[model samples]
Target: MNMLYLSVRQGSEKARIWQICDELLARNGVPPSGREVADIYVAEGGNQGTGFTQYSHWKKEYLARQEQAAPREAILLSPGTVTFRSMSVTADGTIMLPADIRRAMLLDEDGRVTVSVVDGELRVISPMVAVRQLQRRTRELVPAGTLVSDELIAERRQEAEAR
Candidate 1:
């Protein structure tokens, strides 16, 4: 029944009780049990029923706040973009991708990554994603209905004839 004689302002007894509960929980990084919180409230000039009810409501809100603040490994970013800063690379040349990036890149199939350096930045790309990017770029650069393979073959034939 460790408690403090806290001065409660007029009409702010509930706030004072909740503040006491927070301070009690924050002390030593280990929360007191429900009975302890209720006992402390009683020691602070509050009745048993109000103390227990206030402590219960305060506990629920505290847990909800903690859950909301917890970090999540998987998160959504803008389309076609996943970014990480200051990620560690092991001495054995292994880099662990975050869960959101892995999910966005569809890395679950074979877990293969194509590593490349572009513009002095390390890039880890999925094989299928890389191929899709290449196809999209080629389509943007080449005209429709143009046979690039046939043109390459014709140039090869002319070079052989000249030789």
Candidate 2:
């Protein structure tokens, strides 16, 4: 919340101009309004300052950085489409999948599953399906009838069994 007063350099009064610009800049894609700008001004602790003067230095700096910004390093959150459902870990540390999802995945109560995190969402897959998927993907990547391919398939099978 570091702030600069435009009036300070001029030895005059408050700094409203930069404050207006900063609020406008901070609004990202939202259409502008006087209320939104005033809200931003108040939210940035503007009311505390003398004569309500000055804009946030961070806001100005943010715009500058955005102008020359590199690609953002950010995580992709899964689309939260799973509705009317919440799960808790059981005493045995296993979550019982919902009836809908279990039916969709064609899973039985006694069936074994491979659980994985993809795009921050929990995924449950059948081990056989997983193995076949791996084999298919491996075949696509590695040429057939290679010693390395055979070894990799064997290793993957072993790992899958161990899980």
Candidate 3:
């Protein structure tokens, strides 16, 4: 997100800047760290350090927003994905991921993912996984709760079983 700078006339300017940054992060996925952007801003623009200070404050707010999502997104794991396995984290913290699995996930440079530790194994997942898992419980994906007839539900369940 572009940092807000040089317009010191308004009282709610800081909040406005932070909301923009929050939307930017959500749209583009989290960066390596918020500080890196601010550091680059100063390096490129030669502005006084106020931008860095503003970013530091916004980073805390952005991170808090991320934290707020954790609980709401929690899900009970499927039998297969919950199985135990061993893994080793690389020195630089990369975990080896299978190409087929990565392809199935459709991961991209700007994509965001969720990681879980299940029985000592690394579980990197797409947000769709949570929605699907919740579907098992609520039988609906959208919060508006579209009604599904029992016959249709049973037919779909049978079809899923056949697969």
What is candidate 1's local distance difference test score?
0.65
Residue 92 alpha-carbon offset, candidate 2, angstroms: 4.3
- Order candidates by lDDT, high to low: 1, 3, 2
- Per-model TM values vs. the true structure: 0.36, 0.26, 0.30
Candidate 1 displacement at residue 40 in angstroms? 67
For model 1, the superposed segments whose C-alpha errors exceed 4 Å read 1-79, 118-120, 144-163
Which segments of model 3 are wrong by more than 4 Å?
Answer: 1-88, 96-98, 106-109, 140-163
Candidate 1 per-residue C-alpha lDDT over 75-118 given as tens digits, one digit per residue, 9 for 90 to 100: 22212556656788899987777766776774522376778798
Q: Is candidate 1 or candidate 2 better by lDDT?
A: 1
lDDT of 1 at 67: 51
* Candidate number achieving the greatest TM-score relative to the actual structure: 1
Q: How do the residues 25-106 of candidate 3 rate in per-residue lDDT, one tens digit apiece?
A: 6666753233454454456553436544565567555445555656633422222233345667799997765644544564
